[model samples]
Target: MKTHLYKMLLAAGIILFSISSCKKFGDTNIDPTRSSNMDPSVQLTTAQLRFSGDLNVNERTSFMMTMPLVQHIAGSYSNRWGGIYFNSPNVMGVLWEDSYGSDLVNIIDAVKRTTDVAAQSNLNAVCRIMKVYSFARMTDLYGDIPYSEAGLGIKAKFDTQAEIYDSFFRELTAASVQLNTARDAVKGDIFYNGDINAWKKFANSLHLRLAMRLVKINPTKAKTEAQLAFNAGVFTSNADICKTVHEDIQNPYEEVGKGNIKGNGVSASFFNGGAVPGRFTTPFLNQLNSTNDPRMKYMVKNYVDLPGGNPLNRIDITEPLLAVTGGYFGVNPGNYIWDDFKSAIAITVPGVGAYSALNNDQKAQPANFLLRFNAPFLHLTYAEVELLLAEATFRFGATFGGTASSHYQKGIEAAMLQLSLFPGGPTIPSTEINAFLQGNALIAGRELELINTQLWITLFLNGPEAYANWRRSGFPVLTPGTNAEEPGESLTIPRRFEYPYTEEEQNRVNFEKVLPALGGVDSWNGRVWWDKL
Candidate 1:
């Protein structure tokens, strides 16, 4: 009887407590406002990190190497060259959207909220410059892109290519001027290490680059900007070249092994035992060989066994001679060895089957370059500017009344010297480069091609400017491969990438506003305002 009475009292107490707790549960929750107070600094940092990788991947694959297809030095599965088919059209659009939505917008927010006033100011300036640089590239590639209200979450609007270019120039100019202001340095600048002077120099170099780009359309203004940038003093040597470096481990947007979630990135070719070589077209290669250009050895490789020259197991044989009959190949022109003796460390093991079968560790590590690491990411080099001057002076030799050939030679020499600073040996030998110029009469018609071709080659990794120059001058006379998918089209080199998909879906109103001015919607062939040709 005592036990039964005790159990009954315990059950009654439990029920009473449960009823009271349920009534008060809603009142016990934390304030909703407290969640909003969470620090945004860490989130912004994460955005920056993501942007770095995104930029590196997009730059290396599509922009830097696409010309190989245009020039017919490389081949894909279809073996077509001269135009990049929309194999992965989304790659272009997604990158553009991410730049504004995921990267720049977050950066702007971080700059506004940073506790260190001086750091905050510099960060804002940096973001502005970066945005200008990025957007300028976007507009240059894809005729018109969303700009003015791009990163306003769901409230973004699209801007015209013309407007985008104008904004880029204006913002770049403003950022350059801002750099001149005496503000404390940005502490976490992974690119220039908080050096405002370096940032200023970079700004000026970029300004000069952008200005020079408009030479065909606005020579006078271009000349003025170039002169101003020159007078301000920009990068004169390789040390001033901007690039980002990477460690053996934590490399810039590179891939890791199987089951690795944090692997940087891997191209389709990387997964296969070999990389897709962006080989050269026959015409481009033949021209270089005919001139005995030194850069040929640096850029071409022979992976296949030559017909009747050597068998698969030939011992102590000479390197296979490659005739670029169709497409582009090779990672770095200099990476490949002409002979078996020169195979990479990982490829030397006889039983490993060949260089093609080597694992990631066994293969060559690609040097990831960015604006921060200065060996190769040249925004505006003194040599390039000098060459442009040479071209301009030569073009109007009648008015200038000087030996155009001399300036042309000087430009050639400077470009050749610039190659010496590449990760590998110089693309071309100085002697060969000089010999070619000497052999070819530097007349008006020939001289322009000569200067522009060299310029195109020197600015290899720099795609945006190179593409612009190609469209403007049509130098190097790229001949379409006979094996191109669109064989019927006449020497069709793509002028620009199509407008990103996001603009049509999200920013439809503003996108349509710029359509009439661009000839029509869905016109990838439309040229930027500055591209006079």
Candidate 2:
């Protein structure tokens, strides 16, 4: 009941921010009903929800572009940009457009409004941490972006990824250190409910995440930050995972799915009641199917198109993989066309008769299966932190803590266990999880590939982060099983998305300066600064 009220209040706060956002800003523009000195709490709620809960950016940047680029999903009308390497500048630009247009504006205002006010110190500290979280995602997406001058509601110049990352480390360090639990708790903190300690841990964990990103470009700095974050403490358990709480607010308008703070944007990106947006690629499913993974039931199930063609019914059909294509969960990309896919998965069982399965388990999306509306947007997880620790310990050794194998086991368990947080989400039996862990131990030579492949699995819904990690650690070696002359495959996937299309016209001089770094063309083929490896 308290959670419900908070959602109502946060929704109201978002409405307030939206009013200011939708209106013109300047001396002449004023909202008399709204306070001249509105509470920074309002802006914080607005920023958090908009950043993690926005459907527009989730759909365009994550669902459409990054997910398929990393091949977690593929072969849908919406995924042409990433799936087949079709270039769509509009899709690539949505995160920049959405963030600058709304999310950044509010968060920046929150940071500025509370900056030297002693009473709002804890609030200010939290906002600073959020600022790093928000900006880190943006900078990671586009190599050099308008950071310092961003959110001033004007055309701003750009900053290199190096400058932006340096600021992230500084901000995270200060915010985690500045958090004072003795002070008054911050209101409207939907992530932690004003738990300053949790916020501290999250800051350090996030610091660790950003540090690992520096490995390819600057291993020395990476080692230093990882050790610093470790000594300061990171997430110790699932209770410490940094995530925003959400309500299963029925989206009144999903096709245009933004502005609803209570609905989960990541899930909404996959929510097409009348149609399946995409299918899990065979290479991805092989990661589970090849191992007889216990989580298979949680992630994959068969779908049948009934005789009446009554929009794909969910069923428990699991026996035809080896019978058809020598054991693969999904049809080959070569057979992605419907007619080809139909014959590939089509089979005649005695009791079941003749029926064709949908391309992948995600055809069950209309029923809110894996992509539940209330599922929390997992920003940072203990599982992810542990996995990173495992990799760091493997590379940099004891300074990062614990044996690589021990951390690897904890990470796998945590990843499987965390699924229970989803409403009606599947739960693997303890025996199964244990058996799977026992079967797969982190052996010496394959440590990097094994750790990173797990990272890819853990990053299911958060597409952009998965895409970035895939670029950083070339794991699980995705393939079309061909020479694969396309940009995104074995070693050289498309490195970055093109800059926002309007930047050429809106911020021309500054935009022109970055193009030379992109090899004289604003193409996705260009690598970002940290993509040096």
Candidate 3:
């Protein structure tokens, strides 16, 4: 009787515990869709953060890919499309998380919950700005994004790239007007720290950037928008520049792929001898060297030989292709690095390696920045404005006011000054800068290209904007890459990245609508709507 009683008690206890657990399992008393937890306004900042990474990758590849399309293209590789490279699948990952998965839902829900006049105004402005900014960037990158019906979950429909671009400007204008009105402080202005003035400036700067995009397709509209932005006093100087920052501490997604210790660990081939391991192309090296520009040191490391040193070629040695190709100091016959050097070093790198061998070297050069505290994301700067003025004056004459050459001179000076703001950035002597400009002054026929080219170099790390300007002015006199044998050899510069493959696969109906106009998934030669010229 005692044994049976004990067994019955044990069974009862188990059943009691199971029932209690089920009652509280999915009810933590917390809403997953709260704004503080996952608002689109906050989450979309990831896109802005990822922008810098993508810019760096694109800039690195453009030397061979896009630059070659124009002229004097130097690098040889299987990717003829200028290596429109992405460091991570994270761009899409972040997009999905922020848009459909959580952030978007929270932002819309917050807008619904807030009825207080001040709270509603603040929330609405933030949401509009973020949604517009996110959609603008997405459309800029891939084209034909879902705008009108986006973030509506399964009901979302793809919008035309052209239409989306139109909505972007309209939304920016509307948001700016809304922001201009009084309200409670913006609840979460991550980019600008809830500063209304800064947001206004950002909005206008974005306007300037978008307006410039219309250069080829709608010059009148572009000029009008630029003038309006100027009148509004957008981005008066470098302090107003915007950029994302990574904590000095490393996060899983923080460092470049091959270089991240947490990700790939260390390999001997990546740190051969004293070379920083990844050297730039000889032409790129030579150009900076010739310019005597100060930025070269900050931009590229000189491990093999310092700036004035010989161009060392590591051509000899009959080691296995993988081992030979993998060394930090040399290039192989067929342009193989990891493949040729595998015997010497066995490892796979997703991106760049650490400059120092230590895994947690606190002082390791930080990852090429996505954005940063000191370096602001440049919506537009005085330098760019000056360059535009220079070009406008030159092409349209005094009707546009300043002398082309004078405006050009100012533009160059502003660019030099802008570079000075970066850590270890170059310091051009005023005399040297003046001398360089005087020496390379643009003539009546060449002023337009000259001004645009200077603007191009100044706009480094800003790919989409620079590419748009290039489409407009056709400046800088670039030659196509050295390898003209690639299949798309006929074009001068890649128009845009082909839309992602997944877009066509998953969003078929919307994809079909735009298919007739698409240049195909592999075709970087297709131009954006603004690049009609």
Maximum-lDDT candidate? 2
Model 3: worst 10 consecutive residues (lDDT sum): 260-269
TM-score each candidate: 0.68, 0.87, 0.64
Cα error of candidate 2 at position 60, Å: 1.2
The lDDT for every candidate, in the order shown, is 0.48, 0.73, 0.46
Better of 1 and 3 by lDDT: 1
- In the range 377-487, model 3's lDDT, one tens digit per residue, is 454566886777676555444644467777777777777777655543466678877766666666777777667767776765454556557766777554443332223
TM-score attained by model 3? 0.64
- Stretches of candidate 1 above 4 Å error? 1-65, 78-88, 107-121, 180-182, 249-275, 304-382, 392-411, 417-442, 481-491
Report how far residue 51 has shifted in candidate 3, in Å. 3.9
Across residues 169-241, which tens digit of lDDT does each residue of candidate 1 receive?
6766776676644675554343455567776677767776677677787777766666666556665555565
1 or 3: which has the higher TM-score? 1
- The deviation in Å at residue 3 for candidate 3 is 60
- How big is the positional error of residue 433 in model 3, measured in Å on the Cα after superposition? 3.0
